[model samples]
Target: MNDQPAADTARRLTTQEAARALGVKPATVYAYVSRGRLTNRRDPVGRGSTFDAGEVEALALRSRREAAAPAGELSVRTSLTLIEDDRYWFRGVDAVELASRYPYEEVAEWLWTGGPRPGARFTAPPEALAAARRAVAALPEHSGPVDRLRVAVAAAAVTDPLRFDLSEEAVLGSARSLVPTLAGALLELGAPAGDGAPVARELWSRLTAADPEPRALEVLDLALGLLTDHDLAASTLAVRVAASARAHPYAAVSAGLGALEGPLHGAAGRLAHRMLVEVLERGGAAPVVAEYLRAGRAVPGLGHRLYRGEDPRAGALFGRLADLPQAAPALAAARDVTAVMARHGLHANVDLALAVLTVSCGMRAEAGETVFAVARTAGWIAHALEEYQERPLRMRPSGQYQGPRPPQPLP
Candidate 1:
């Protein structure tokens, strides 16, 4: 066998390739995309973005990675889709369509069950869910809601007798119990727990905007459905990696949660909201792009790993902007930045839309990541369940490093 690898098949890249070739990140390539300065076309296979080979070469001449990067073998293939590009499809249904049209709860059912809602009504055991809900409800009102939610999950796993079962029914029930309960806990802590209501509904009410339009549930369902799962993101990958080891659901969720807490995964939504305001407050659209460029930061909501040019999800959510009149300030900023930035080569993603959603709904600025945590828990659970049943190996690899051969002295 030859030691030298064959030429790479990834000759043509989309924005990311060009960006990589440009000695910058993909988001910078997004700047060029938004500017329409480079030549690009659709990825014929999945209808995502594709980069031009010649353009990539041109930019690669100046790239830092041109010589240092070496080609390698493609090793593992798994059922998970990490680094998902373009559309988020679950069981072959487009996630963008779902999030735009369905209620959040309905989306949860679909994600947890991996099947459309069958019967008109169904019931899960209330005991675990109620306990989980009560636990979350006790968090301090001013505490980080997401952290409190994670703690409640850990507590519930410790308290519950059935946490180790890992059966399909058990996992599903746990999901139904956990998500609703987490949301409820936040609401109760924010307002008053068990004041006079069923906990789940109270949380949902708090999560949603006060003046929802007639189609609010439909919109939430669709959004939740859209976000519930995508190809394996970093958070999803962490969940799947944990699950691949037959880790407990709580453990898997914890791994995923840790990943999501990073700025790369969960901070985008809040950043978009804040950035839009900063742009508007400074000097409208004129200074927004320049400020980001000077700071060497990408416009938060405008670029994506999967969407080559315009993010389809962004377009879908943009369609809903008309429904929210109260978000004018943020909207104006979003519109101005989007308009100006597109001239350079970027399109908004779910983060941008969600930022708009948060602003329009009168939701607190801090709630963006919390909402994401709530929505993404379903996927984490599903992946965990899949890992519990499917993978043969748990984990075995360990590190070997140079060290003193002598054993450590006892204290």
Candidate 2:
């Protein structure tokens, strides 16, 4: 017992060490800090970073238990992609490179209709456009764009003609019509007219507010480009599952949205933004760090699961954000928080960076969610098209029950 205190005082571990002690991933460790679920003090060199070894062990021990189900049985694999390596290939081009040059609409068009007008405008079969519009209009008033999008997908599924064929035209048409419909419904509360206007143009008009500035459009475009796709995230996987089941485009997208609604997957940006604001609102990073240490509360937006080291994308965007006037303050604070956090040596994830971006743009909490929904629609459509090429019909998993055999034992 005496040795314990001596050892703990002598040796302090980084957040990585603490994560290992807790048998959780390093990212999970950062999440704990962000959420105020765990606390660690700073080292002498830094203001607030050093964590007590004993505290970590106690937390880890408290969490450890027998598996809920045997490991092998519990580990089910699917086609859900994570895109941990390499660039997002939009058609044949790299997404990161293209987004720097093209408008968000172009990227969206590429994802939906295939690289730059390969064919004629995808016109959804006559009644389908009207039905999509009606669905949008029907979304309860004052609903969020993303929520409205989810509802619209559900409503459109029933009325979508050519849903069963999974043909190229059907997929492309669905992409064009649905994107604008959701954009209009969410942005304007008006349904799609399915008129002569180009899908991209209509969507851009609706997405912007009245009296928008030059930068606002640019920001919107940039945000769209940023959120577009992440290889095979949970939402994209959901879209694939629906596609594999031969569900139509709208149904498939609805599936993706369902996955996005989960806290762990898509709500990350919102969570990070809230946490950062709380830090700023209470009294900058120092006091916030102090209180966090005292309370054992974790900080948000300071970590990632995929990037064991650091998120390259976060680093890249961080550099570019120096000039944006609107998002500059939040961006600066993020920089401060990140620099200060290095005493602890944890890196920022996309969520953290995006939260900063969101704040810089002066968007509502809901806007983050909306951005995710809109950006991911392109991926969902792509996945749906992929599924169409695969074995259609039902792609749902089979259930195998494991329980005591009943009648024979009784007999």
Candidate 3:
């Protein structure tokens, strides 16, 4: 009887090949090893470690299973948005198509209600704007935009005498003003505020030193629409939990802002921005990709659990950027990075496209979070409104006792 392991059992997949089969990045393969989700055998004949092919396949299957796992307590009925088949639908409307024609004001309203109003207005009362400015100013100058936004929301709630009014009409009114007012106050905190324009334009002025291009403004508007709502994102769930307790719209949004600060959520865009900036600054994509792989860092902005192939939002935005002459160099660099990552089967997601847009438009590094926070506020309010109508405090979940049961005496 042969004691040697069968050749099939001994087969190993190189990092690149493993990543392709697993539909992730090489760094992720290393991460799986580090986390003990997979095992790697050092190749005596080759330079880099290789993974057991069978184990890699097992991990890939587990990933797919997890993606389809039942929501359990995380599931809540929401008619606001749907992300399926690599596309986002807002109330049964194609987000990409809707984004091309509408500003954030109209898109946000559509999310809140079931209908789209063509000429809806977005305005912030002068007093609320002034109060928000003072509130934002109270935060330390070093605070991130998201932190300041949270501060502003809490402060707005404090100053509003009628914040307890949670009626649908009142909520919608406050929601309309909330996003633009947050934009205005944050703008006043640093850069000069734009002349009263769309909220996207005002946000653009606040985030960059460069003059706004029409195409860039349009792109920003489209991005805002695309990002306004994604069903049950971590931050959105946080918002819903707060809203379930009958929190004011401002408080609910504050909850969301708090959650967005996590790296795995909205802040991912900022990480992606930094990565793209490094690529552009180093004047090449390969070096940056190689450096990340060497350090065993997951390449930010590539791959998503929800999208099987290209993220539709990323594809749509990248398609728009393709036509803009100003974005040519940055777009070229992004493509190079994508090409390198494609070899490992990692595709760009919305965060990557957003980073590209932010860098191309000369926005600050943290502007990605800024955009995500502001846009998602619309969704948060919509969700809050939905939660307000349901039974309060419905999010309570039971815990399973996995730990040693209170150190019971040995029998």
- The models' CA-based lDDT, in order, is 0.63, 0.63, 0.82
Q: Please give, for residues 1-411, the per-residue lDDT of candidate 1 as tens digits.
A: 123223422556766556656655555465455434465666557665767677777655533333333333212223323434565565455666655655556665666655677321223245555666676667776756566767767766765676777777777766766665566545532343243333233444666546444444334444555577665678877887777666678778888888877777888887887876677578686687787888998888888867776677667766766565665667677878888887777877878877776776656665567767877888788667655543234332334557867788866
TM-scores of the models, in the given order? 0.69, 0.67, 0.79
Candidate 3, 70-181: lDDT as tens digits: 5473457677888888888988899888877888889999899878789776887788888888988888878998888987787677767777898778899888878888
**lDDT tens per residue, model 2, 359-379:** 665555555676668777876
Give the winner by TM-score: 3
lDDT, residue 254, model 1: 80
Which 10 consecutive positions of candidate 3 have the poorest summed lDDT? 187-196
* Count of clashing pairs, candidate 3: 0
RMSD of each: 14.8, 19.4, 18.9
TM-score-based ranking: 3, 1, 2
The candidate maximizing lDDT is: 3
RMSD of 1: 14.8
Clashes of 2: 16
